[model samples]
Target chain A: MSTNPANHSTPVNTAAGKLAVGWALVGVPLAYGVYETLTRVAALFG
Target chain B: MGFLDRERTIAPAGFNRWLVPPAALAVHLCIGQAYATSVYKTALVKHFGASLTEIGLIFSIAIVMLGLSAAIMGTWVDRNGPRKAMFTSAMFWTGGFLIGSLGIFTHQLWLVYLGYGVVGGIGLGIGYISPVSTLIKWFPDRPGLATGMAIMGFGGGALIASPVSTALLKAYDPNSGAQGWVASGDAVGKLFLTLAVAYLVYMLFGAFTIKVPADGWRPAGFDPATVKAAKLVTTENVSARNAVKTPQFWLVWVALFCNVTAGIGILEQAAPMIQDFFRTSDGASAVSAAVAAGFVGLLSIGNMAGRFAWSATSDITGRKRIYMLYLGVGAVLYTVLALAGSSTTILYVALAFLIISFYGGGFATVPAYLRDLFGTFQVGAIHGRLLTAWSAAGVAGPLIVNAFLDAQGKPGQLTAASYQPALLTMVALLVVGFVANLLVKPVSARFHEPRPDRERPHEPAMEA
Candidate 1:
């Protein structure tokens, strides 16, 4: 599907800023969790 | 409260579809904390001076409640929309932590059961399915990728929660050790309060930001007819009530049940199974406790990654073909592990990791699979009912593995030879899943619901 934000008419909540913030809210924490788990996983090779 | 209504959540014409996934992730990440209960299991056991089984029951109750609440409330979620459902889920989930915290402070075990197990479980159930259908609607061209992103959060949630909970317990209890530290009950109670507040904020953010695509809205350049032309892809709708009557639904359920049961067998036993496989004749293990833990962490990564990577692959390969790989290849992996898994630790880890990835794939792909067979109309509800298989497998998987192990020998003393029976059993179960996936045909025309004139502007009308 087209990855562009819907541009047919006036956008409602689809602003570029809002999309960045939304992704950050969930992404930062998920990334942190994965990072911590990876640190532990390093022990297997060590 | 009105802000949580379905109509209020409809996306405006220019709303970015990409934004919806993060909203779904917010809820899933918070609810996925359910899997991290082991972080505090020992602390609760020490605080209450209870048996291991009693503390374990808290998680069991939560999982059982997750399946039950999802099945019972799925239709309600479908009718009410994602916003209201997410709001309700946040309330129950955080409230569960609140009540559970109170139970810990008061040293009342039953209260913890009521709070975390029953109340929080309902939250897990609702929050799990809430964003699924909306995500599907937003990305009709790539339903697997959309649902995979959200459900992947569920697996990732525990990854964050495990380490986070440990750190919180240390902060709450100054005496908590770096190794084998069991926080005091008081510290655990405080930890719950913190999680309750943190999760509430995250979940509410998700509920507020989430939006349903306006009816008849398809992504630009996405044609429903193209989707329909694919094998088993349907543009027609099916009511949640009638979905249960179809053979396709049950076949999928059986397939999921088998896949999960086999996967859980490995997951539940991962840490010890590794040590046992490499145990020396002198009764010492080559794998250390710390390394065994790393193995578990590695499996979590596999589990989380497969949810996204394999499920996204389904968009191109088709759901049926992807499941064939999961079940068919999964059975072969199990046999290899059972026979030669003891030969080398690296080999064993690779086999186990791939099997767990397929297990995760089974979960992430099923919703899209349902959409293919049943359509979007009540896909969330059907997906919810299908989760009863997960709850059953949660029980059956451990039971089957443990029963075989018990017959062979005791827990800590058993070797790879003892695990062979259970491993072979899982191999047999995956074969059952493979056959079930083979039998899944499209939902028959007699079961199709008449298309609503307002809903499908781009597709042909259904016969019924």
Candidate 2:
């Protein structure tokens, strides 16, 4: 059973990369939405 | 078709569990667009030459469809994996937008109802539950946190879509952003087309990326026994069919219905109610319209934040104890608001924020509670059936508030005293929910599947 080191690392690396990008895809928009909402929310006191 | 199968979606060893939350978020955020229809509502009313009631029916129909479809398709969603369910949801959702756009272009209201209301509503129902079971399975140790992150996206979805929809309308018609401006029907049609295409891509990404945990997978160093150690938490499996037969199901239903009802009492009337509460002797409101709008926005923040924060907190506090806070303390908060809310703005805002957060918390916490009571065997389906409570509350909450207000005076002219009756009614409802929560006990043995152990490992090839 020949297990290449690079092949073993590839799935792990891909999984890590996917995690970051996936969170960013949802997180960036949610952050923007929150920022906009906060700006309006600030007006409640102002 | 093969790619979307439950067997195909089973995760390989070492797949990152963190990736699944975003996948759930993608579908939720897209379906969350349902909340942003108000941005273009006036335009639709103007274009269709319909009454406000008629225009609003579009939203009403969609909500009804959401509850109905979720109840109908829940078991189906559980049988299939998240991948197929998410994909089907994406297709129906985008298809609704496309059909709705066509209706707008052709000037037909029924088509709009069929497209966005019935079809899009089904999308909402399926999409809402699609990722929940998967997220629960992935993080059985922290089911509250896992489900909270996904459900919070549903709340946050409106936040993103409202601004984006406004921007799209502004881009289409520069005057749409001006004071009291309504975009043209053509612009809204174009907006629908754009959203359908964009959401299709986004939801497709979510569907493809989502993977179920491999059979018997558990997070590192996590013990399943610890979860069942709590009094209410169970290691038993109850099929969705049997779950409905149990009194525990209806008790949770009452708790959810009351929580949602009280929250809607504040949400539905936040803008006008704030102004009404602070109105001067001669009918002038000390709170400006802009400030009232901001107050509504603040409540929205409370609503969204509560969904995530309170739900995650349940992971530590335990689900039943959290519901005690939501329903029991919720009743107390309503009492104070009804009694003294008129005295100060700060008191009113603070109390309303807390109540609404409990409302959101109730929503986010129920799935985990169901997981505790019913087990994960059909938690998604049970949760789906549970959402019918939301639909009932939606109608009842507004009716209760409005009926009392109508007895007092017209809109834009009422006072805080006028709202006291309704507010007190909510307090009573919350008490009922609190009692229901108190009465909740374990499901009887007969409801459990006949298997030796309820926490059966996933057999991907097994039929329901």
Candidate 3:
């Protein structure tokens, strides 16, 4: 249930900031994975 | 700074709801380690000298408990809200890992089940729904995208955990020989403790960071009319109690069950299926274990991507249309994967990737679908009940895949031919789900609460 708004916008993350943070959460870790997988793949080829 | 204080969680007028997703992600990413149960499965099998099935049951019990706890604790989540739910979740999940680690060290099998399976399962369920209702409330204009953001973390959670856990296990016991650093139960126990601490810290960040959207909050320049105009996207609220009584709920449940079960057809057998499908000359050699691992990784990427991509797309295409794509189009993908066989490596990879994406999409999309049909009032609880479908699929998918393969009379070095029947069976399951999705209609007005209760409802009256 929603209580009354304090009427002060906290604006913690700008729209762009929100999108950036959202993707970064997934992207940073996934990048780690991609790098890891590539390392393994290279070993397979080697 | 007091994380569990309810008053502290109220969003100010300018509170940007976007911060919520990262918070949700914090919890989900940690719990997603449950998917990486394989990271320790072999170690446990060797350490305990247990059958693979016995080791595998840890995952099963956790999954089944996830469904049960989510269904049972959903309303509690709604009443107490995400902050408390997430805090509670952190304790159980992190505690489960520690307790489970102790089980490994003690060589007690049931402790693993009790700690990881039962207790951790409770954490999984609570953590899963902790953000659903809050996200729905925050991003009313984009329910699908809101849920996708957090649920995608779940789909992607294992990506982070798998490597981290493996590295930790290795560090604990580097002298593991050819079997690698995975043979020692002590290392596994220590790894569990490491994970428990790491996850607790991350999830605490989530609980601390999370705040519910203010009452009656909406995005800038958004019009409620635009959403109300969509078909089957209701403006009415339905109690979780009444929601289960509705036909639409059952339809969505069936649809999710089928989607998950079909996806597990591959997920439950990712390694073996890949090796079997691409066997070498005269069936003497299959794909290397490394390649199979790579294939699983590829599928994981697809899975995570699908959760975001498809769920976001649902914002524009509408939830119903996306389910059509997931079920109707997914059946076609299964058929293609089955017919295409092990013909080419690229073909196999491509088809499996697509199927897995839809699988992840199915999960991320369902919460939004529930919000559409049932309203945010009880969407979390409804979503919790729906996860029971996942529990059922967890068992059914493996059984179907393994049984069909087993009945074919080959035990070892299974070929591409071994998977045809199961894949076809997956196609059939998708067909059944497609029909179920087709049957989903708007919840009838009779089930809707008469008034939109703005405050959380009081605890139920004791039945004498």
Candidate 4:
């Protein structure tokens, strides 16, 4: 999938690409955090 | 130019990035000390003859307030910037300790709660988010590592506080009735005063040291769109208000709540749980019990280390892959903990530490992830809203673990073995998290709105 061309200029090899990669790196653990949180709530309901 | 503008315009060369983490560490390490509340549980119970419920409330109130304060202060931090936020955080945090010292001296439980839980919790919330958004903007090329470095301090904060609190408690030895036998009240008061002074100094360092990145400062040779195209996550900018309205927000909420609840089951009661497990069959002594408390501190070390190491590692491996490792491997480790049933101390401790690391890693990595999905536009505010998950986990994790323990008839009794039910319940939670992680499809294209002309020159809509 291509990123919206309007929001970003220059290709993936540009500074924007590095910034996106940086954000994704942080996002991994973030996704887990959300997972961790929801399951804890589920435990209470059960 | 204003300090914010001046700071942003001048990028330091070489060792500049090093300053941000330590500044962040000062606050995190201080508030992370909350992890050591278990160290004081016995003190509160012994001194005030407080009930288990009352003791739990102290910590719970603090955590709940932490979330509330963060939600309120986040927008202010965005508008005013980290310096003002950190300055305010330092004042409240240090002042809370001072006030708490008075509460302990006067034997007023309500005062203690007000001081530490409400006042201090606000400090924690402000201090916690102060550096996060700025760090992401500053190190846009390495958001994961940059934020991880600062956040790891928060995880480690408890590691530092646990040993310090233990040492101070021993030094005071209120029972000795000697020169050092300060009344428990006096000792607690003095401790708070000392911590108050120290935190003020440390937090001031953070406030003064913080700097935002200049506008239009992209990393050398990096393209944003190409990277967004490769990742299945969102690249759209969504306001915190709009972000909460989407399904994606709730999905992430579920995921965090599960992971934290599973970890806190072991964390909130680590020392007593270990001792009880050991004593039921073998009858460990008081000294051994004290040693178990140290294990809690060790877990803090693991938690802190993982926040930095794993999150930073995610920068290279991809966030999805690291999370897969956390949920998949975490489930296996938790299962081993359940089956092991305290047979080998080594297995129990090792497994607990690993799980805590994943827990801490989850926290350290999420803001960056939010930035990825929602864009940096109102990420600090969005992140604050997301922290409601932590507040929920704070209540849920302890309730599940403690309720099960309470149902089993308190730790020292013969029926304490019934904690196996809670452990099994945690394992089930992990499985649910694993499913949620799997269900997380990339952010939908519908969520990506067109950028305003002010943000960029005319361009086509991005693909998903």
By lDDT, who's the top model here? 1
Residue B39 accuracy (lDDT) in model 3: 84
Model 1, residue pairs in steric clash: none
Using all chains and alpha carbons, the TM-scores for the candidates as numbered come to: 0.95, 0.96, 0.91, 0.81
Residue B219 of model 3, lDDT score: 88
Overall lDDT per candidate, in order of appearance: 0.93, 0.90, 0.85, 0.71
lDDT of 1 by residue, B1-464 (tens): 78888999998766789999999999999999998999999999999999999999999999999999999999899999999999999999999999999999999999999999999999999999999999999999999999999999999999999999989999999887657667999999999999999999999999999999998998999988889888789887777788888889999999999999999999999999999999988999999999999999999999999999999999999999999999999999999999999999899999999999999999999999999998999899999999999999999999999999999998789898899899999999999999999999887776777554554443423333
How many angstroms is residue B165 displaced in model 1 relative to the true structure, after the best TM-score fit?
Answer: 0.6
Between candidates 1 and 3, the one scoring higher on TM-score is: 1
For residue B387, model 1's alpha carbon misses the true position, in angstroms, by 0.5
Better of 1 and 4 by lDDT: 1
What DockQ class does candidate 3 belong to?
acceptable
TM-score per model (chain B): 0.97, 0.96, 0.95, 0.87
- Once superposed on the true structure, which residue ranges of model 1 sit more than 4 Å away at CA? A1-14, B177-180, B452-464
lDDT tens per residue, model 2, B1-464: 69899999998877889999999999998998887788899999999999988998888888888888999999999999899999999999999999999999999999999999999999999999999999999999999998889888888888999889989988988676578788999999999999999999999999999999988899999999898788888887889988888899999999999999999999989999988889888988889888887897788778888988999999999988899999889999999998899899999999999998898888888899999999998999999999999989988999999999999999877999999999999999999999999899988777777675454344322234
**On a 0 to 1 TM-score scale, where does candidate 2 land against the true structure?**
0.96
DockQ of 1: 0.50
